[model samples]
Target chain A: MNLKKPLTAETISLDLKGDSKDAILAEMVDLLVASGHIRDREAVLKAVLEREKRMSTGMQNGIAIPHGKTDSVDCLVAALGIKRGGVDFGALDGQPSNIFVMTVSPDSRTGPHIQFLAEISRPLNDAAVRAKLLAATSPDEVLHLLIG
Target chain B: MSGPAELHPLVQFVFQLGVLIVLTRVGGYWLRRWFRLPGVLGELIVGMLIGPYALGRFAWPGLGHLFGLAPGGGAVTPELHAVATFASIVLLFLSGLETDLSAFLRYSVVGTVVGIGGVVFSFYLGAGCAIWFGLASGWLDPTALFLGAIATATSVGISARILSERRKMASPEGVTILAAAVFDDVLGIIVLAIVVGMVRAAGDGQGIAWADILLIAGKAFGFWIGATAIGLLLARRFSRILKYFQSPEAIAALALGCALLLAGLSEMVGLAMIIGAYIMGLSLSRTDLVQVIQKEVEGLHNVLVPVFFATMGMMVDFGAVQAVLKVGVVYSLLAVASKVLGCGLPALFCGFNRHGAVRVGVGMLPRGEVALIVAGIGLTSGAIGQDVFGIAILMTLVTTLLGPMLLAGSFENPASGLRKPEDAAKTESKEIVLSFPSPDMADFMRARIVRAFRQEEFYVYRLAPDTPTYHIRKDEMFFTLECEGDTVVLRVTAQYEALARLVVVEEMLALRSMLHMAQENVNIETMEHELVAGLFSDDGEDGP
Candidate 1:
């Protein structure tokens, strides 16, 4: 599944403040809310976290996709946070996860949500893209590097 | 990458791990497919093949460097050895977790009887063999006692893995074997303490003090009982303390930290690190955190256990093997016979039939890590000379190899119902839901919905994506991606759900952390407060 909507620069942050996965996830979920991407912060945070326990979304190459599908957001919503000194996301590779792609969707939409997840995952598979995303100075650079 | 001197410590560790994992997999597959032997046997062989005793002996350029040796690698470095030791600790920890405490308690009577029989018989028989067949007379008593103690040890990891692979973990014979093995470990350690203490006493020109002997044994048991009681009492509070943090690494770190702490403490009290780690596992075995600890520690175990096994393989000195070859055969045979007769008769008397008793006896034959440690201690302490130490090592290697063969054969005799069908169909299903439920309604409904499912029949997880895709267990039903969309599709397939409930608890903690971040003032100490008390209590009060 490929994501139809483009991730805007407004919802992306280069400086994530949390030292742990939960704290980072909270920061990311807060970004999505502050950016008007999702409405109920607690509900979305709970849903994203509930999904987290099933398994970590931390992928190889220091990327973590912490996502949830709930009615807290009307349509597809996504946010990104980057911490220079990575937080332990309990990745299989046992490396700290630096790049976080947070997504929240309406509970009714399965196809587009799956597509969005796949789309985020696909670009991350490229080492060059991953490196570029990590090295990018701002969210604009990250968006261009990821979605370009 | 060019030289061992230039490679980063992290890089060296990664390379070593990569080599070990690849070789263990390939070698283990070949052994299982062709010889029908345990994978561990193959790992040991592969380890020897690539170790300093063999390929590295020839000064294979890159191989030596990769294993953390000089260009022409001589021995594994202290750093690498430390890694193996860490692996050993993790291995013992995992063995402890896999232990069924209730079953251990249930079979304690028979297990203790069988264990004592095996220990006494093996000790006396092995000591008699060592003393009678040996030319030296002056140091006979201590040497024989040390050798006897070495024989009494049973490798819980080796036997447990073999039984698990055979799918006999739940069988009566397996339970008895495990119980006996546990008892054997405690008994073996005590025997070692007495022998070592006696040797030290004689070296100092003093007779063995009865008071000192009693004290040492008391310390061993006291440490175990005390640690278990204290650890269990504190485990729930520790779990609650951990819930305050959202890092998945926190739980594993805490668990491993505790294991190491106890291991160090045990060593400080003159007990083995393995004993300490095992005790730590037992202490947490009944707690809410056992599942959580198991979930986080599995990854560490996979990496470290192989290192321990492979390093053990590397310890086999070919010269020792050659020198002791003739005596080794006799000692090995004596070792096996002693365990079989010693452990077997007790099992038979304890309501097990002839075949079950034989199986139990065969199971105890592998003197893996424990034997090596005992031999090493004896050699270093001068209780046994190099040649005798060589003989002990040879005896350990032979017994280790012979164990799986006899164990497999005993299982194949078909007289007992212990052997489960290898290809039994599993009834569990893994459900993947691609639904477009309202994001608002999804969170409100999840806890309520999942709570309605009987906890006994269905184990559910809200966040389970932390597991590697390959490791995504089949039996677990996990909910993910709560988003609003156009349609909902549910797909169900059979899989394992062993980690199902553990995942839910982990998710609840994660959510708790999130809530703490959202509300800076609320002090949520447990899942009940944030999950059940805060959210679920007012479920119907809000509608999307």
Candidate 2:
């Protein structure tokens, strides 16, 4: 898995806007499309939602990782969104989720998808890393904070 | 009757009704809103406070003049008493209507045994106490026998009120309690007759009438069985007649009139009037008019039940506090304990686990009007003194108070292994849509689809998501939670249909716990029921 490939300023939205989980997810999906990582927008959105159905992606520390494997995407892709006013994702801890990391990968691949999921989750689990990501004001600042 | 001018019974009744209604409603509201006590308890407390035995004494100069002291130590005027009696019948009628006859029939065997157990055990303890007291203090044997009869009584109304408030009246324990109480009434009537007859014979120095005992038993059984059978058979046809009157009010009136008619019939057949009212209610419970009838009667229940409870409170003197303490406390303890073990043990023997048995026992503890009637009969016949009557009253009050409390506890921590799931889906203001991959790799998942989706607490979300572009299964009649392609969209229903759904939804959650378990590979058993059948499909057919 290439951790550096998807960590671009264009794929990160520091000031995401959405009142609900779907809106937040949509905002992040828009970021991935705008960044030229995917071709079929509808297929990827459906795939992301399909992942959400299996279980809520919302984890502890105000974060959610909504990801899916689908034929619509040619390569592994990622997008991040931060909505300060959290949306309820039916979080396990019952807290509103503010940080969302949406991932789309090709259906033929298994190794990179698993490895990419691990790479994304490792730094997010740390309290200081999460604090820095949450404090970042711009997409550039968020990328620097995330990949640093 | 002794007042300067006998206030026209109507005028006196109006004032009495006004006071009773205000005190009970205000007091019930206060307790329910602030103190969180049961509404019925509030009514009972208000009745006690303002009754002639307490505050009514101070108001005797003016208010008491208007409300005449319960002439001759009995509570309520002849006019008000008549209304309260009607209220009692209405209350029982509602109870009967709510009784699920099909559920009652299912548990009839266990319910009957528990009822018999409750009657026999309570009778022995009560009669033994009376015998011991009689042997030591020169109390009459006839009085002891009468007291024994009183001990066999169980107040279904009190338990029914508390259970109905909690919505547990439809539960297994609730059905068992109702059935047992019905049996208790029948058995109590027979026991009371035989004992009362024996007392009468001994008092007159005449031999016991064998014919009278048989006749009394026959009458109680004949009335209950005959009325219930006839009522059930005629219920649907009677409901059809009510279709001529389209209004809900007309239907309610017809229902209440039937209840009143049955109550009168019950009295004629040597049975409690409420027994007939209850049977009448049960007969009409399955009719199409039941929902409308229930809604109509609810207003009447709110007004009338409070009056019945409050009047019951007014009957308590409390001035006999010291004498009641001397005789009432020990007897009340014995009475409560006997019913608990008696009803509870038989319930367990009949296959109810411990929790269900405890509920049955607690439900039977309250004695209410039935026990009071027995004591009243004993008192009027000169078979028992006023002190024993006071003891019985005190016992009734204590048991009534304790019953709702214990019954509430028994239901809260039911013996069922599963906990009551929170109605999270129901409480959610916004609809939530969940999407998942349709299980295509596993053939086993295909076979279990219908059973897995079969109606339970949770239902599949049928509607397409608000997003217009992403649509699937729009024309399908039944919402199978399946969408186009590999993905399926499942709408969350509040019902927790399976324990496995909880585990599946908390996938990341288990990761934390899995890390704690570190070395051991976790076995996934949730898909076993679906997958195991597929693995054995190729094997030769086994025993049927």
CAPRI-wise, candidate 1 is incorrect
Native contacts recovered by candidate 1, as a share?
Answer: 0.00
lDDT of 1 by residue, B152-225 (tens): 98875556556545545435566567678867876775676556645665566454555565665566567777
What is the docking quality class of candidate 2?
Answer: incorrect
For candidate 2, lDDT tens digit of each residue in B197-260?
4566556645445555566556656666787888889999989988679898998899899899
Question: What is the DockQ of the complex in model 1?
Answer: 0.01
DockQ of the candidate models in sequence: 0.01, 0.01
lDDT score of residue B174 within candidate 2? 64
lDDT of 2: 0.66
